[model samples]
Target: MSEVAFRLFAERGFDNTTVEQIAAAAGLSRTTFFRYFGTKEELVLGRVGEFGREIADALAARPAGERPWEALRRAFDVIAEPRPGETGAPMDIIRLLSDACALMTRQWEKTQGWQSMLVPEISRRLGGPGPATDMRAGALVAAAISCLDAATDAWTAGGGVVSLADLTDQAMGVLREPGDVPG
Candidate 1:
């Protein structure tokens, strides 16, 4: 369903594609499509909940002694790793997102939601909460997401020569620096 929708959107442009058209192209009835994905936005947005759950699980599985930021970085590394047979979907998704503001907004919202869900889990993994725990969690999530966004933007802007991991690390390095470093 998602693959069909992405293809249709790429071919017809987002505004020109309709739910019905996506349904027909995917060989699914309108009711079936609705049952699977509630709205046109969802068709373009894809399975956000599933991906969030996967990231949450990955974070949870990290060793208890791992720093929250480190664990989150590893989780992102896991996410950015290319799958066995997948070719260019990640780059294509980045392009589609760059071309559509609404889709980009939805993607940001999804990332924020996932970060919120992971915070408490990260807190727990780091042992009992302290006075600064919540603040630290929020900051860690924000920094990790900022890294991902910068990485994606840099990769897209560079015509995809630089790896997402490299850009992500560059973003991470900014945060890892001592407080005295000049901007």
Candidate 2:
């Protein structure tokens, strides 16, 4: 259903594509579509809830010795990295979602949702939450998100010539000093 809707969204604009069209494309009734997705936006942003949990779990499981940036990068990679034998599908979904400004905004909004959850967790991992700890957590989360967004944009623009994981590593590397490489 999501793939069908994504194809329709790619062919037609996101705003121009309607739930009826998505339902028809999927060969499902409007009622069934509503049963699965309450709104068209859900077709794009729905995975956030599921993936968000995975990301949070990954973050929580990171070694306490890891730097916040490295920890966050690994957490993102947990969700973003494709499984074996699956290469282009994840990138295809990202590119399709990127084609729409609305979806892009939703992506950021979802990231913010993650940020909200991560800040306190990261703070706890850093010791405890306070002005300084909270700020550090917030800054790390924001920077990691920026890197992910930039990497995703580059991957989409470059037609995925570069591996997404490499791009992600490079983007996260930008957080470190020129002489410093993140492990």
The model with the greatest TM-score is 1
Error of 1 at 28 (Å): 2.7
Off by over 4 Å in 1: 10-12, 84-91, 130-133, 178-183
In the range 1-183, model 1's lDDT, one tens digit per residue, is 787888887898777788999899989999999998888877656655455677788888888776676778777765565555442255456667777777888888877778777777765754536424666666677777888888888887887787777777787777775543211
In model 2, residue pairs whose N, Cα or C atoms come closer than 3 Å (at least 3 residues apart or on different chains), thus clashing, are none
lDDT of 1 at 41: 77
Per-candidate TM equals 0.80, 0.79
Location of the lowest summed lDDT over 10 successive residues in candidate 1: 82-91
Q: lDDT for model 2, on a 0 to 1 scale?
A: 0.76
What is the lDDT of every predicted structure here?
0.72, 0.76
- lDDT per residue as tens, model 2, 148-172: 8889888888988897888999998
